[model samples]
Target: MTGNLHAGALLLAAAPIGRPEDASPRLREALSAAPVVAAEDTRRLRRLAGDLGVAVTGRIVSYYDQNEASRATELLAELLAGRDVLVITDAGMPGVSDPGYRLVREAVAHDVRVTVLPGPSAVTTALVVSGLPTDRFCFEGFPPRKAGERSRRFAALADEPRTMVFFEAPHRLAATLEALAEAFGADRPAAVCRELTKTYEEIRRAPLGALAEWAADGVRGEITLVVGGAPEPAGLSDPADLAAAVADRVAAGTPRKEAITAVAKENGVPKRVVYDAVVAAK
Candidate 1:
């Protein structure tokens, strides 16, 4: 219903994260009315359609990660032919750590109209439910698979003030939590949401260290992790305090210049202030 009349529009549909009942009415209509439906998993699409009691009259094609690039071209052709194409993933919105991004990019390149049928989102759902600050937040879809890369990524984000949301596989949950605790400190608050909106939905809120221990036993189902932002350091205005903070980092093998910058950022002070304090302490 939201596409251009002359050229077929690309519709990005958001599927329910868990329950079929959470699917939007617009999505049901799109499934029935679109000329072509590109689904990440054709079998899951059919099952979802059946659950909604709607018969899909459109041509359903597989558009998963393996076939995403090659299939995007075919779907784009359908759009140029004035046939509306609806993209749906296994759960949640398409192009969100899922297939459909390539097609959306191609469609835009060819001047194809694009629209969205928004519904449930695991990112926002997990953020609100986690009781973390919602005013500012970011979604980090998944962490690097390698231990070294993951550690570096977390280190870079250690000073990020906005709440962070992440999606992760069950098998990697324990290791990821442990790495997070190391990077963000064991006392940092976080929440692990599993099987959101499902019958066995669970949310565990605790310090990063405790959650790491809890996940060591293993977990199942989909996972969304929400971690509170780095807390601002308090009452470290004294030059001796700043110098001591830099000295501690230097003793731990961090470069003096880097340590000064880090301490300044962490305490909401200027780099010059920290540098001057370090020099004066010498």
Candidate 2:
């Protein structure tokens, strides 16, 4: 049975990624108060509601990739009719590499109010604990499963400066990590966060090569990989060359110390490298 549509509002709530205790109060209220709830997996939704001690008072319907397009039309009509509909995924925010994008798009086209109750997200959770630079980062939902395609994808981002995050199935983790190491370099730092927020939650930080070796034995859980960005451009191998580059900065009245730091940062090298260059130039 449909509950109150609340002026045809569409609420996008994030379900707990793992631990149900992480579920926010707003999520509980939304689950119990919404007139209609569209879930990527209705069974999982029921389980989550149970864990949160929330009895979903609203009508729950299956909404997933396979049926998202058709479901959007039906859900949109309900929203337009002033029925409050809540859209949630199996985990994390809907429309983020998950279902709910279609409904949100339809809701906007029909001038329906759309809102979000942000909560647990594997992407952000993995990033923060990834030990990788969070200031500049990008999320690449899931890598292409095919070997050649996956290699090409990693090759395309070979020179990416921003830290990168990607989701991968457990069974393919080892092979994917090896490809990443090959394309991004073996020594590139990275983190493998698995089953985040779950009882067996594991976070392993190491060079891509090491991670590849570790996962070779096989893993079992949701996986998120955060890889450090590519190093600075090539051809500045000579310390003398780096020193010379900093010389120009120093000439511009940017103190030697500042010049060295700036040059190293711009070239994505260790500050010590630039500092040693300045010292060696003297």
Candidate 3:
């Protein structure tokens, strides 16, 4: 019953993450009324429509990573024709590490009206349940498959102060945990949310090292990892403070030159500043 249907618009619909009962009435209406429904999986779309007992009168087309570009153009044309097109994914909202982004981007470029029928999102769901700080967080979809690439990915985020969310395959969860522990430090707190909103749901909250060890036994089902952000670096209010830190490292057997460099890097200040402080202390 949305006026945009006849006026031509792009509707991004959110599908239920697990249970069909969670589907909203607006989703049912959108599925039944849109001129065309672009789905990540056509079969899943049909199945979801069936579950909702809503007949999809419009055409259903697959819109996945492989065919997104070509299909997005096609959908944009439909939008230009003044026909509302609804975009949906297998689960959760479209465009969240899903195939709807290209279509949405094209729609915006073409001056097509874009709207969302928001519903379930695995990202927020896992974040709230993660027991980590949620005031600030970032989603790092999926890490690289290669060991070296994954290590680099974690290394880049090692100093990030926002909570981090990630999706990982069951088989690789343990290895990914190990890599995270190594990059972020073993005692960094994190949580593993498995099969969210589904039967056999499990949430394991602990330090990265403990989770790594637990996952070594192998894990199954969908996985969402939430890692606590890096603790804030101590403030260096005074040059004397910098000198004291460098001196501590030096007393721990690090050479004066190396300690100054390390302290400068850690404090994100200039080595010259730290060296000046060290000299002033002497």
Candidate of highest TM-score: 3
Clash totals, every prediction: 0, 3, 0
lDDT of all predictions, in order shown?
A: 0.93, 0.90, 0.91
Q: Show where candidate 1 strays beyond 4 Å.
A: 1-5, 235-273, 276-282
Tens digits of per-residue lDDT for model 2, 47-87: 99988899998888999999999999999888877889999
Tell me each candidate's RMSD, in Å, in order.
Answer: 3.9, 8.5, 3.2
- Candidate 2 backbone collisions, by pair: 5-83, 5-84, 8-82
Instruction: For candidate 3, write residues 68-159 as lDDT tens digits.
Output: 99999898888888888999999998999888888878777666788999999999999999899999999999999999999999999998
* lDDT tens per residue, model 1, 187-226: 9999999999999999999999999999999999999999
lDDT of 3: 0.91
Candidate 2 to truth, TM? 0.81
Q: What C-alpha lDDT, on a 0 to 100 scale, does residue 168 get in candidate 3?
A: 93
- C-alpha RMSD in Å of predicted model 1 compared with the true structure: 3.9
Candidate 3 regions with alpha-carbon error over 4 angstroms: 1-7, 235-237, 247-253, 261-282
Model 3: how far residue 64 lies from native, Å:
0.3
